[model samples]
Target: MFLDNEDKISIDRVVEELENRPELQHVYLHKLFKRDHHKGQRYHEKQISLYAEYDRPNLLPFLRDSTHCPLEKALEICQQRNFVEETVYLPSRMGNSHSALKMIMEELQDVDKAIEFAKEQDDGELWEDLILYSIDKPPFITGLLNNIGTHVDPILLIHRIKEGMEIPNLRDSLVKILQDYNLQILLREGCKKILVADSLSLLKKMHRTQMKGVLVDEENICESCLSPILPSDASKSFSVVVFHCRHMFHRECLPVSNTVSSVQFCNICSAKHRGPGSAVLEMKK
Candidate 1:
């Protein structure tokens, strides 16, 4: 039900019913109202006190005063209804998960409102339910990220991991959400390291021209046939070697063949090398 658009329920009647309803006596409406903003609109404290005393069949007129409440605070009231009623938990009252999900999907016609609602759910189960409902709906994620981008905010998916929840999958789902928004770079750099059997040499060549190649750390020895020295230990050959064009690489790590005929770019920087036979590897120190 789009409360703002279609649900014509009067606020006053609801408040009246709430006052007479024994289930709501323990619900401290005052605490919630105190924490929220009412803007510049004046509200009489006396009115609330008197209104609370009314046990009438209809009080829509008094409740209609909520129209003056700020949008965020008004939203909180609607969400509180979900918890107050608790009828949603009854399969007969609100249907099973599938039916409830379908109903939420229909109600989420307003992306902004839906996202606001999503943020209010501190429970992981509710978040999972919302995500499952949104799986087929692309707007859910798109709208969520767009809201974050616009507001420069982050989604508080789960306040904290709770017992009985699939912890690993929850973390992975969060990662997927970050990646989908192209925001994974927010994570640590070490985690992004590319690992491959031959990645070291390939990276050396690729970055040659783009940077001043200098291998600071070298480890392990090649189990392959060891000539004068092992290829894996190449990084330990020289402290540093400067190329003719001023490019540099670890002397030990230099390719045994020193083949550069097809290599047109420096290993560190992408500097174009048109010089004869590529610069010779000369010692820097």
Candidate 2:
């Protein structure tokens, strides 16, 4: 009769009876939720509170499956009951993961869980808080030391460990930290060696290319003055500069600048003829 929605009297009577049994209220609510989900939304907050009030085992499951329950109110209810799991979960679900982690460390006292939570959040502030919470607590310190080497600086924890504290497996933790440092050093050395080898290979290639030099004959003309770079006299004393782009210049034809920090240009090159080659030369003596 209570299953039939049309039988308001029977449902009302059963609801009144179940009200006297707070433990069974959530069960009835879950039944109503199963029968008609849209209708169940109206009772969602009530069901959540009932589960929290009775400290029901299926509180988490109920929360996971239900919607329309105000999370803030539920968080308040769970906190008042000191329901560690729900309190932590509610805050985390609301994006307050730090508060959840705080509860996990302070109330649950599970170092592994706290570390994993911090890792999942991957926030710097959260990791720092975790380290701060673990300080002076030997077991927590040991747990953090065993882990977090690759993810965080071990020195942050090592230097902060209390002077008189005792940590089990402290030797193992130290060895792991040393091994991590040695591995990092080896990786850096390997990268440096690779870079040096690459540089040497590039230098050798450049040397081979330089050996096959530019051909200079009498026909080459100066870009600045449009005059032949090499005169017909084979024994003439002359100085010429040949660029990689094959533009040639007689030493005396190009104008020189004495200013310490100014661009080198040629009024003749611009006025006479120019090439596509481009460069900025800075000379300091």
Candidate 3:
């Protein structure tokens, strides 16, 4: 069959090509072959017969692109550390194809395989974002909350929506989580945003190389009054306002008198400052 670069290949064209070229029969058979890894034998001959019905070359692109459901299942299985079940049951366009064969040869770990699957399926961005949320990274978690300041409220809302937990207790628990870790379970679909000031502070802190202790050791610094804050569960998820002068205080920690005018008394140094509040999201734990 004479093929043109611009011609769209359909199932009819694929059938014509396969019938005309005897060599393609081997390629078709190779694509459908399923080997039993443990016993070193092939699966039932029916598996190939079943696959042959839908083996149109033109359908491969669509099948590969429409892999979100299996991708999600694979992610869940990977997170649960069930690689065998995932590899065996998870469906994809390139099932045991040359690319999958290469991946199998590499003998990659589950997470690595997930990453490769994401790349191969062209869903790397989505899977990567999900992995970031699923994996608990303290700094990334804290940084996320510091940006949006939406964790406490949104988490409480989600819990309420789920309706499987006590509202009051869950609200309190979420508040505490927000306060200690600034842990943000990302609710946004595809994009992440955080406060510029908070991000810069985190960046500066991360670049510091002269630390004398463990990186995540919590230092008790009071948000309000800039005083040496004590560890308190009640103080969790409370928003703070930091000044350009490095002065900081809890938005709620400040006296109600401060709201009457732009100038507010600093609880720590008792200094008067003027400017809009610079919201500080705290990550205590």
Q: Highest lDDT: give the candidate number.
A: 2
Worst 10 residues of 2 by lDDT: 276-285
Off by over 4 Å in 1: 1-105, 144-285
Candidate order, lDDT descending:
2, 1, 3
Any residue pairs clashing in model 3, and if so which?
147-194, 147-195, 179-237, 180-284, 180-285, 222-229, 223-249, 224-249, 225-268
| TM-score, predicted candidate 1 vs. hidden true structure | 0.22
Clashes of each: 25, 0, 9
Which pairs clash in the backbone of model 2?
none
Number of the top-ranking candidate, with TM-score as the measure: 2
Over the stretch 1-285, how does candidate 1's per-residue lDDT look in tens digits? 212322474434444556666334313333233334242134333233333344222122334444353333322343454422122212212225443333455643555554454454334454555555554445564554444332223354333223454443444455656664565454434354644535887867755753554332333221122222223454554334444445555545556544354443445555555433334433433
- Residue 136 alpha-carbon offset, candidate 1, angstroms: 3.7
How far is 50's C-alpha from truth in model 3 (Å)?
Answer: 99
lDDT of 1: 0.41
